[model samples]
Target: MPDEMALLVAEVFEAAGVLRRSGEAIAAADGQTQARWQLLSVVSEEPLTVARAARRLGIARQGVQRVANDLVREDLAVFRPNPDHRGSPLLALTPHGRRVLDKITRRATEVHRTLAADIPVDEIIRARALLHRLVERVNRHEGDGRIPPG
Candidate 1:
């Protein structure tokens, strides 16, 4: 039998792969792109500094800056003066960005419904709770300088 930790690690990897693949499949259908989706998603919530969005997305500041520049050029997002930071600006989604995200959301919902038809609602709820607990535990352990065991 597989060890408990090994099974957990396998499940984690599988879950991550599923999410990535699902996102890719959805993006492919409409010729949508990941960077654009992520940029718009972040800006959809609230205006954020490029550096802040980079940190939130776990990407390099330079990469975020490049994406932000492209978004500005495409008129999908705009940079407004940041009162909180000296020279850095806040990124906001344009109406075009909002429409793109809305379409993506509807498509993603359809994808989810199709893929999740076989999954029990209670099982999904339980899995969500377990994943939240796992994240919390790992974060706590990492914060205290301990390596979280798989």
Candidate 2:
């Protein structure tokens, strides 16, 4: 039999793919892609520099910059002057962007509700806990896993 840990990792990747596709469809209704929607969501709370947003999203700064530029072009978001740093401005969503994000969020909530209809809340909680533990352990390893497992 395949190692359980390996199988769990595989399952996580599969789940991510499904979730990404579902998110893409939800975002598409508002003329947005998954990447754009994610960036918008991140900045919806407060403005952050492209570098900060990229770090938060665990994605490349250049990629976030591209998405931020596109959002600005679409009038969904704006780049405002940053008092903290003159060179790197913070990315903030426009009024239109807030409406778009709200719409997408509502749609996503509905879809998630339907998807979780059959699953017990406790089971879902347990699964989330397990995933969280796995994520913490993975982060502790950083990029290299050469350390001997204790």
Candidate 3:
């Protein structure tokens, strides 16, 4: 049997693959607008400064700025002056953005329901809880400037 650490690593990789595949499937179903979808998805939840959004998305600030600009042009997102930051702006989803997110959420719910139907509901809930715990642990460790030992 694989060592505990090795097993954990493998599970992590597998989970990441599943997430990537699910994202691709969602994108395919919605059409070819990954940036727009991502932007809409984030802004729908809460307003985020461009820099913070870029950091959360793991993309460069310039790239996020471009995407935000496009979203503004399309009337999907609006840039509001950031009272906290001198020159930076916070991005908020427009009404159109909310509508798009509603549609996407419905489709995502359907996909998740179909995918989870074969698994026991309890198992799914447990898995989600575990994943959330893992994420929280990692974030806490990273925030303290410590790399989690492999």
Q: Clashes in each model (backbone N, CA, C under 3 Å)?
A: 0, 0, 0
Clashing pairs in 2: none
Q: Model 3: clashing residue pairs?
A: none
TM-score of each: 0.86, 0.93, 0.79
lDDT of 2 by residue, 1-150 (tens): 779999888999999999999999999998899999999999999999999999999899999999999999999999999998999999999999999999999999999999999999999999999999987877777646754533
Compose the digit string of candidate 3's lDDT tens values, residues 63-82: 88988998888888999988
Which runs in model 2 stand beyond 4 Å of their true positions? 143-150
Regarding lDDT, does 1 or 3 come out ahead?
1
Compose the digit string of candidate 1's lDDT tens values, residues 47-135: 99999998888788898898889888888899999988869899999998788778887899898999889999999999899888997
Better of 1 and 2 by lDDT: 2
